[model samples]
Target: MILSPSRGETCDHCLAVTVSIQDAEPWCPHCEWNLDRYEPARRPPEFGWRWIDRRTHRLAYRLTRDQFDALVADGIDRRGPALARVVTIGASLLLLVGVVLVAAFGVWLVVHDFPSLTIPFGLAALGLAVVLRPRFGRLDESAYVLDRDQTPSLFDLVDEVARAIGAPAPDVVAVNDDFNAYATSIGLRRARVLCIGLPLWGALPAQERVALLGHELAHFVNGDVRRLLLTQPAFTMLGTAADLVRPVSTFALPQSALMGWAGELLAEIVQRVLARLLFTVHVVLVAVGLRDAQRAEYLADELAAEAAGSAAAVNLLDTLLIGETMEMVVRRDARAGHGPDQWRRSSEQARTSAGPILPALRQLSLRDQASLFATHPPPGLRARMIQERTAQGPAVALDQARLERIDSELARHYDRTVRNISWGG
Candidate 1:
């Protein structure tokens, strides 16, 4: 459906396009360029820009090549993966060490005749697989067609690139308001869909949409999705263990963040209680071997960029809106605010074809750790990567003024809408 108009025409501030004569109405619904700028809607960012996924570079709308490059390099943090690999090796070694240690500790439990959880845990594992397998089966049936319309949107573009990387088509799809696309396993290759949210596709430019899809597809092709699922049982158990350790750490007030984090990770040490002694060795063995989750995200980004070309990666941030902090939204309404509909909208909106695709990364505070870690990489890191090798284009900064105008216009439109309703009543 075509969206309605604002109070008047002439686009409030700029005379570039008027709402009165707009084909779609409401200040040119087909293209919602930044309102504050007097510049042409299709202009590039003032500074030259470089895309992060590839080694090639370009001039941005305005941001300098040197400055942007520094930020991008700083933003990406693959250090976690390196650390995780070492930990995996160390964890493996600890399994062997833990066996002897646990055996000594078990003498007390054995003599005291503590109940054996071996059978219980085995039963639990079986029960869990039984329960989850059906769920997976159900997902296989529904994931591809779950959406009301299942509009193919970016999926077709995604499939083109994903096939090269060996990813199958998604079995199901969900259209929501958010700017994200994720794949969950369904049963036996039937309906494993590459679900795309409508809001995201609608919001971004086609290239940006392609980039996003390419990234999600990479997750499937790289077996990241499967590994994620397989780790669930262990991850759940570890989470519970972490919860238990939280109190102990708080009670002890370990000297530093490292020690505190280490204490919480004692879930690793505690879970060996349920598994075989041999399993404990395995646990420690593989602990550091797995890629860091954050690193995996970066890897996926790179893969997507490569698949679609760096240009896709270049405008990715533009399409993504920071929106509300998930924590805040959860706290406020608990359910209504972050509902599926809103999520889908966010996704579709991120694909705006007119002007820029996404909103800038909203900087929350000087010391907000949550904001920095909210995305796969810090904004500075991703932004820098794109601008690293370039020196000419419209700077994304120009959008700030336009965004402010849109927000004000939206607010006014709503206010008038309320006044009209009250008067009629």
Candidate 2:
């Protein structure tokens, strides 16, 4: 549904066409002005005072403020959260056990029980096991993957950053259209895939980019429970199951006779109850691992500081705080036919414009807090911690010339990414 500018409004940034679409805020489609305020209806609320969320938030804040040094001093160790790791791994094992038990029971029922009704029930149970089976992480097909051979300079920089932090370099790097970047393990071998988001990458400074790399690469060795092989599958499996089981609506129900309607209603209730249960368990798993997860994040930030310097690391966190604005600017430029060439300048301008408001935004972060279920600590807290600690200069710095060469190598990927952005892909 395309919405035309009703009031003949133009974008403040580029004087381009502006419009308000259904379930979206009024914003310029051409230059993306006012788009920062445009929240998509599809996105869920990011933070709330729900039981687990609230508890997690409180715990995160306490860790950030009261126990910051103690955690830093403790360093990365298997002993940090034994019970949490045990519970998380146990949950994953139980999921696997559940699948095997269900499949075995189904086979027994099919082989030994009455074939008429029992066979159908047995097949249904087997199908349920298949649906609930654990899955390993895999790279998204849409991602533009770059190998070391394809991007030597970029890989060299990554290798340098990994060496600086004393961590393993990613096996592969993938670029996507997301507004954020992540480092995750994939396949049975747990090969690390470093996913760099074009939107965020385009907006960051060279040193901040190095900091970003440092932070993500540090995750490889930081002992992040969620990323560990033993617990990662459980998180992936449970999260997938939770997403598959959503509240069923009455209006979506099929038409039926009176008795049939009652039976369907009972079934719907059971389904909804099961959905709620899955979601609750997922939430509990997140809550249980929240502290250790947050500790890993802070530790990663510290390592990022060591790898790229404290100033760059803190600045990177600030950039993250303004991530939404940066995304809007990048999208605006891409849609305006300005493309990647114009993104850095526009993003710099956006960052400059945000300076006055950055403090307020940081305060807002403290007041509202980050989501408890999130893997990282609050951006504001992360930045503050870096600043409060001793300052460190970059151990492995990338000169401007090398940075440009790396960009030159990634130019084609950036162009493809920008094209996708323009088409709303």
Candidate 3:
């Protein structure tokens, strides 16, 4: 389907009407046309020298390309969550084994009366403790948490969508100024929180809002919330390990300049080696976590399409491209003393101005090959998936009056929040 153009311009290549946010230049979706023959292509998976690279990408996704195709063809229940569960369990077990090894080493050193070894082992255990300790200290403190009483209509809509999708309603809902929406679990109890970026929320059309909400809510059903809870510790542990080996400044050394210089030199050399080693480990952990995260994103997209219709789902993704440019426009206008009313107008104008640059942005993005670290698939890939799996269904019907009421409730809060946010500060 041709996306509604941001500026309502017809594609010159195909003479077909295009959606502004959806069609990035060089390639026209309507005609399957490419203007640039030399554009970098997506790299093919290789099994020989690039075995680890290939395995990383495969491990990151819930299904292989062929499996996704088969799943789409057969119309079966998604196995993403189950597959992700196995991967998460494997990662956790690996981490547990490492912890056990470290603890055993520390105990052996203590028993053998090796002060030097025991001291390092004790520090290692302490660092590991810091890394593995789950933290959700400031989750709700950072945002404006909404009460059901404060947003009855919005809660009503959320409840309706949750029921339709068979996902639990989020325990906490909040609004912020970002141009994104996400779900996060907090604390040991793993309470779910849904945060909606007010700027993005306000900018979406009513139908697209349904798509966005469905996409975020679907994370709960797809086990993304639980997976994140399980996997984040690996990243935290790696970060802690990095910090433990990071070089300390030698500037505070005693008054002897020669001694200080030698200390500084030694510190720098040690730091450089340790940094490289720690960074390699960090990269591997990120690679392991990324596949499942990306898979979860695609699965969520599928659920969103199922709940909100293919068109809206595609539009929502397209809007993400537009949203990036919108943010730049908002920041520029804000600096120029544009108030909330002026900011909204400037955002619309920015959306139109930024449309032409999207194709270039997309082309630039293609230069970076897919990796385990990428959180989402490239826009072109996601768009194609949605198009290929396009299902014919009506979006969940929302009461227009309730939607309008929700808008009113959000507008007041958004304006206040945006105006108060000091970007420079």
Predicted structure with the largest lDDT when compared to the true one: 2
- Please give the lDDT score for candidate 1: 0.40
Q: Of the candidates shown, which would achieve the greatest TM-score relative to the real structure?
A: 2
Query: RMSD per prediction, one decimal?
Result: 17.1, 9.7, 7.6
Worst 10 residues of 3 by lDDT: 32-41
Each candidate's TM vs. the true structure?
A: 0.42, 0.76, 0.70
Number of backbone clashes in candidate 3: 8
Query: What is the lDDT of every predicted structure here?
Result: 0.40, 0.74, 0.64
Evaluated at residue 355, the lDDT of candidate 2 is 78
lDDT of 2 by residue, 91-151 (tens): 8788788778999998887888465668887888888778777656799887888877777
| TM-score head-to-head 2 vs 3, winner | 2
lDDT of 3: 0.64
Across residues 107-171, which tens digit of lDDT does each residue of candidate 1 receive? 54444435564544444444433432212334332222432223232234444666744567665
After superposition, candidate 1 runs with Cα above 4 Å error: 1-155, 164-166, 177-179, 187-192, 222-226, 241-291, 324-375, 386-425
